[model samples]
Target: MVNEPSNSANGGARRPWITTVAILLVVLLAVGAYLKLRPRRIRISVVQPALQAVSSSITTNGKIEPIHSFEAHAPLAVTVKKVLIKEGDRVKAGQLLLVLDDSRARSDLALARTRLKTAQAGYSALLAGGSQQQLLVRQADRQKAITDRDAAQRQLSSLERLQQRGAASPDEVAAARDRFSRAQADLAQLDSQVRYSPQDLARSKAEIADAEANIAVAQETIRNSNIRAPFDGTVYYLPARLGAFVNAGELLLQEADLSQMQVRAFVDEPELGRLAVGETTKITWDALPGRTWQGTVTTVPSTVVNRGSRVVGEVLCKFDNSDRLLLPNLNVSVTIIANSKDNALTVPREAVREDAGHSFLYVLQGNRLHRREIKLGISNLTRVEILSGISQNDIIAVHSFSPAPFSDGVEVKIVENPS
Candidate 1:
């Protein structure tokens, strides 16, 4: 009777309710503990100022170029009969690089020589006193003509006097007048012969000189058919072979003076001011790794090249680390040291961010990130030169954790071992 009374006194209904309430409380507490204690995995990189060394430099893309590269082309139209060199063959100045058929050139030269010889003979004859036989014939003809004209003049004068005095018949006077007119024409023609003699000689000489000039030009064309190297260089590419036809100024071979060479590199505008002539540079070619060649800035182009980036200019660096192993047109990487200052305040590149053209750093203060605007100078790829807004001893945040539980006024318990 007592047990039955106890079951009815506090029924199973109340027991179930109490048990459910306790279970709910335990679940809530466990959830709160999990949220507080669970670690947050984050990706981060550390920040540190890089120390300067002898090899400390700023790297940029570069290319290997020849210092004395030149293209050999045919000087005149000709057919290639033979090529003496192949690509990668060493050549010397004035060495025969190739030979053209030159049959046409030879024919041209022969024709020109024949014309020149004829001109020379004529010129020689002109230089030699006039031919004796021709001179004698002209002189004799002139003298005889003059004699006949004088006789005719005398007869005409007589005829005129007779006509005036009426002592001669009309028919006789007319005959004498006709003879005088014919003689006068002959005398005038004779005088013209003497006047033109020197002019004829001068005309002949000019013709001879013109023919001689043509001959000289033809000879030059023939000589040009035998292609020769203009400078001591290596044959980088030879496009012509025996029996290949070539035209005037057509590319035959490409040669480069390997003894002296340079690397042509484009510098971005942001880094141009840092480059200077005589500044040493380190170069690494993609073809050759683990081997760095030394070079110096020899020249800087004055004009800005319009590439994707507003290229400040092109730089020509003289490579002193040339070996037979190095060839032309090889891609290279160049490193230049803009400047360095000992004990300078610097920070990780990620620590800085741009906002409206102003740079700022996220600094950690009492487990909270603080935004501090900074003045920037030069920067390499990894570190930025800090002009102001930061001290050497200040620890700056390389990354950020924002819009989470922490705010401007929120209290943050920085995980001692932040994952």
Candidate 2:
């Protein structure tokens, strides 16, 4: 009887332990089923569109140049004799800048003058029949011929009268007549030699014209040897030194009126369409840091060219450089304000997505993402101007933390509100 009571006590203790274990198992199974069937929510960051001022600009590298500049080059191969002005000297119009060794030029001018004088003398001789010596010789020859002809004519007349009276033979009279005819022919030839033909006069005139042209050329060369400044400017470059020899067309000096300056900005070909005339430009140079100059775009590129490995267009800009601090051939940084607007609707560039030539944004509606097509306007590096399709009050999803792609009706968990 004692052993049966102990067995019943142990069975009662084991039954309570089994019921507690069954209840724990049922609770765990219900929790797992609930967790597996629950909906998933992707974690995302959201922002609302804002209204602010935005500007679209293009930053590029540019080169500074003078608006009104002059470069002097050697007119011919010559030695630099005198350098009157040094580099960085301010000069006036018609000022003598340098002098070249003009010995050869002067010699050439003298030779040309002598040739002109000779040509003039020859032309004068042609107009006046012949030279003085030739005229005198011809005159003497003509007088001798006239005297011979008169004597011969008298002889022929006497011979004819004598022949009629039988004092002179017929053969003698014929010989006297032949002598008179020969004298007349000799006189005619001498007169022809003293007179100039029309062709001769024309040819003489042509020679004079040629000589005059040579004189003009020689005079011009002499003037060029004396280098002079054609306009008022500053001499920024001087390559001609005293006694240095230079060849034709070699650069001697460069000058400019540093009151105005021009900049040629090289812009990438893709951003060329955004450039326009009259746009505001800001310039900065590494040599003069912290100083910025304002300018205007005077012209846009007409063609595209290759710059290094990039295709770019050259944009021209003009600015007032009255202080003369900016110089020519300086490389500078250029920023052109292509477009600007006040109080325009803007959103972070990350919020917008493009697909198949269409731009859209994912709007957060009641914790779900909705794809809405939006129109975009001017954009910069960080933000873009929203032209249409979403109001500033609507919350938009920039990106999701999960790997799942965002689609319409996708539930989202707001991880952080950036805006």
Candidate 3:
């Protein structure tokens, strides 16, 4: 029965195949159009603002120092005679720390004493009218002058009597009177030499004073050669060695009361305004790992200065060091608590954006980002305090996963909801 197939039968069979093919093409076209025209949702990271405790702080390098410290220096050019204590030794007030060679000072003192003695002798002589020898000479001269005057007076009287009686010539009487007058003048000159004028007394007194001042200075120099602690402290630096020569004003030793300490912190110039007195500070030393010290800002920088490659301000901080674990001039790290708040509405700092000097945040509303201006309070390394324009329950976009920029009214899909 190999007979020709009917055209209507074959046509009916092909029609079903053609219809299925056309339906498949229509489905693909519809899918392509939908993909090209539909709104794109960007994958992003989102976070919810929450109430948290936040603190703003500044950290910088610092140096440990003593609050009340003492330093001893060589008072004059001398050799160190004795070292009574070693470095790091605890000392009491008035404790002798070192002694310098005071032979020169002693010699100077002896010379000054001799000068003072001589000056005093001269001054006493002036007060007593004159020196012992000068007084003796003046007394002898006065006695002789008195005798001569009396003799001349007796002779003048005799001459007058003789003249009246015509026993002596007029020329002899005149000569006796002249002798009496000359003797009287000589006696008067000797008396004036014994008395001292006011100007002479003052000059003598000044010499005595000058000699006494020299003696005092020499004595002080001798005393200073024996170095002593001014207060109870630890000797942290001892540059003077036994038998070592040092110049005047050379550093000998340094000591401090370790019960309290200070830190000279160098803060960047831009961070100076945030520093205030009484602010809490935390300190740590590299030499002592894991150890921490507490302090407060005592002094703020008045001016900025160059520190290495940066401009910085020196801040003073005071703290207690009852244990005395820290040493002077040791480099340390400091943290100043600029501001802190508790139970503040805060969000991730990355969530906030800046535009035209104003802060804004991308708030997620119904799966779409909306730019809303925000008032910020304080900020920390990781979080920022939201003063207004947002609630703790509000969801905000932190960052986007795609390269496309965020805009207002843009749809987003949260890829990461970081806690």
Among these predictions, the greatest TM-score belongs to 3
Sort the predicted structures by TM-score, highest score first.
3, 2, 1
Which rank order by lDDT, best down to worst?
Answer: 3, 2, 1
Off by over 4 Å in 2: 1-26, 29-33, 40-43, 135-210, 401-405, 411-419
Candidate 2 residue pairs that clash = none
Candidate No. with top lDDT: 3
Candidate 3: tens digits of C-alpha lDDT, residues 246-351: 9999999999999899999999998999999999999998878898999899999999999999899999999999999988988999999999999999998888
How much lDDT does candidate 3 score?
Answer: 0.92
188-276 per-residue lDDT for model 2 (tens digits): 88767737888898888888888888888878878988888888989999988999999989999999988889999999999998999
Report model 3's TM-score to 2 decimal places.
0.80
Task: Please write out the lDDT profile of model 1 over residues 212-319, one tens digit for every residue.
Answer: 787777777768777788888899888887887778889988898876678887788776767778888778876677988887889976877876755557888997
Candidate 3 clashing pairs? none
* TM-score of every model versus the real structure: 0.63, 0.76, 0.80
Alpha carbon lDDT of each predicted model = 0.73, 0.90, 0.92
C-alpha root-mean-square deviation, each candidate: 7.0, 4.9, 5.0
Given candidate 3, what's the lDDT at residue 85? 99
TM-score of 2: 0.76
